[model samples]
Target: MWLWITGIICFIVAVRVIYNRRSGVCTSKKLLDGKTAIVTGSSAGIGKETASDLARRGARVILACRNVQKAQKVADDITGTTGNGQIFVKQLDTSDLASVRKFAKEIIDTEKELHILVNNAGIVAPSVKTLTSDGLELTMATNHFGHFLLTNMLLDLLKKSAPSGVVNVSSDGHFFGKNLVVDDLNYEKRPYPSTFACFGQTKLPNVLFTVELAERMEGTGVTTNSLHSGAVNTEIFFKTNKITDYMFGFLFKLMAKDEALGAQTTIHLAVSEDVENISGEYFADCKIAKRSEQAKDRGLAKKLWEMSEMAVSLTQEDHHYAGK
Candidate 1:
């Protein structure tokens, strides 16, 4: 009887510990009244919450998403809730190179200044290998290459808006992806790994891209960083396997954060004055965090940048703008 009572007490304590734990929050009070910010994949999940938070802080927030209708609805909701009518929706499909270029061109043509860019868009690798029309692996294209091209294309504006920031939402899962062969990034000459492994591979590039871009952007006042949002109950898991979705949903609800909590690190990286000069770093839970060894490889980072440029068919003009 005493043993049973002890077990019950311990169970209650464990439950409380799990439920009461919270992720770090961005405590910055900086207002972005005149700032123009773009958040890709802002239609839902962490991206939506991140965009909403920026809008609430008075930024003219643009929802860069693939689904125009869904993004518009999100923009409306953000405007209604925040009373910041500056929220706008623009179409962007990060998996498609053409769509990335189109979105970048429009932003450059219209927006006079860009203060923040949140490369929060990402997708799960399918169980089977998939390829984009551009002949790159679909997962790599969307999660890394597309953002790579977009950021480079907008390099001039980000630089012009001195002290600007580029926040890449990466993941700790990158540690498992050191096997990423930069030479054959698209898996064209190699065997396709499992979905999770492929997903991990894509995440590593996000950090590598941040490291490389930050180095290239030295003296430009455009800080670039990457982060791992704590596990959250997001829809990225539901779009893949039906059988596993239910299990994942249950597990996530019990162990994961809500979207708002998951957005904290991203928010911190974007608007906080604390990290205004901190670039080429990885973060988690609103604080600087250590990255994987592979993520620290400057050689790999440089190689990946060159290959990504070629894969995206970055023009001489685009290269000039980035180097300028």
Candidate 2:
């Protein structure tokens, strides 16, 4: 009877601890006081939730979305309802280099600094092999290259914000990625169902970019990180075919989390005082977490970056985000 009572007491303590931790996380503490944040693709899904969460937390949010009108509407609603209207909206299409550069220049000319940059805008176009204006794979171009270019463009501003962050929203799907074919990143030689193979190379690029960025931005007071927001029931999975769709629909029933939970980790990093200086880490479950074996390989990360640069024809000279 004594042992049973001890076990019950311990269980209750553990449960209470967990409940307090989650409660503390969920209360919207307004922790991001006075900082400025730019959340890409804030029109919908996790991005939208992230924007709202940041705004609620006292971050001056800039909704860098492709749709200016929708972005403004969301911004307006956030400010009007919360009574914290410092939110700004700008048009940015992560898939297009020209738009990215243009947006960068506008920020440079207008704003003096940036605090958090969440590379959250991503597109999972269907199985079709669509190409960007620059003729790279659509998903790769939009999800990775676009953010890479944007980050490079805003490096000066990010550096100015010393002790800032650049977060690339990656995925667990990076586990499936293999050794990148440096000579054929665009699938010019082997383009599988762009959608089927999408989860692999795309997420791999995210990790690679984070690793490379952490190196490039060392000591600039800008830390970088990535995360898998879990199996979110967002539009990404909707891009799959009927068969894949039914399978995922069933799978997500067990794995999926709401957009609020999806944004939890992002908000945690952007504002939490403990992680203010933390960088080059990946997160899940509202905490810093480990990735797969492949994600741990710096060699793979370098190879992916080099191959990606070659594929996109990106060079230091092309870093300027000026007109077109």
Candidate 3:
């Protein structure tokens, strides 16, 4: 009886693995031969896998990461394995506004075309309340605001390369926030119960940003969407205590999808012709997934867009392109 039970368990596990592998597959036939793609935080995890996938498909992929040395190593590995020398590394710290500006300027000045922008870099949550140099919550700043500024800065180029795409890697955790506090996004007024709740608040803005951006870029032929990459086994959860981290990591190894599998939706959004016309939608497992009602609030989305513009301090010229 024990032997039969063990065999049954093994069969179930094998079937589950096979099913997951078959689902969420990206069937993009479009070759990005002359196109350029930017994947922020591509030094490791889902970002690295996503960048490598794009490079394999003939796109001039740029690995935008905070750690130049690490990114360079990943770039080299990607080039060697994919035989796509077009992969290059660029320094970008999304939490810092100055760094974001410099990175965007360099890309705009150097790259002639920008077809895909994958805002994949994100942080879970700091154990304590951490503030960036910009005076905003670190998780919120990096996860949403940085990508917000970067996307607006490159809007013109994206328009020039019409039918382009902007893929924001959001999470189902956005539902944890319940509602967005547009007035106090920095947690000055109300305190968060835990770090996870704070992180969830930041993710809410990602979907909101995607909805508003797609609305603004309506006729420009640029599609913007957000996605939940599923529970991925990545380094983002290392901020906890060692014992807790170890336990969580072990569970993730058993339950979470690998980085390559987690990157399928992102890759699909980036290069799939099927979604070429789809915009302002939330996706999971490479399908149009439902989002929390808060994520679907148009008024909330617009309000957040305005607040984000203010937080980023967009210049008059930048506002022109941002439709402010």
Tens digits of per-residue lDDT, candidate 1, 100-168, equal 999999999999999999999999888778889998899999999999999999988998998899999
Q: What's the lDDT of the predicted structure labeled candidate 3?
A: 0.88
The TM-score of predicted model 2 comes to 0.83
TM-score per candidate, in order?
Answer: 0.94, 0.83, 0.93
State the lDDT of candidate 2 residue by residue for 1-324, as single tens digits.
999999887875675455434522433364777788899998888898889888887888999999899888889898987777788899999888788878877888888778999999986545667778888777887888888878877877888887788888988777766655546667788755445466577787888788777777776788888887766656556655756665775555434565676777777766667676677788876677778777777777777666665765566764522311
Local accuracy of candidate 3 as per-residue lDDT tens digits, 165-229: 89999999998867679878888998754766877899999999999999999888899999998
Provide the lDDT at 107 for model 3: 91
Pitting candidate 2 against candidate 3, the one with the higher lDDT is 3
lDDT of 2: 0.76
Better of 2 and 3 by TM-score: 3
Query: In order, what is each prediction's RMSD in angstroms?
Result: 2.7, 6.9, 2.4
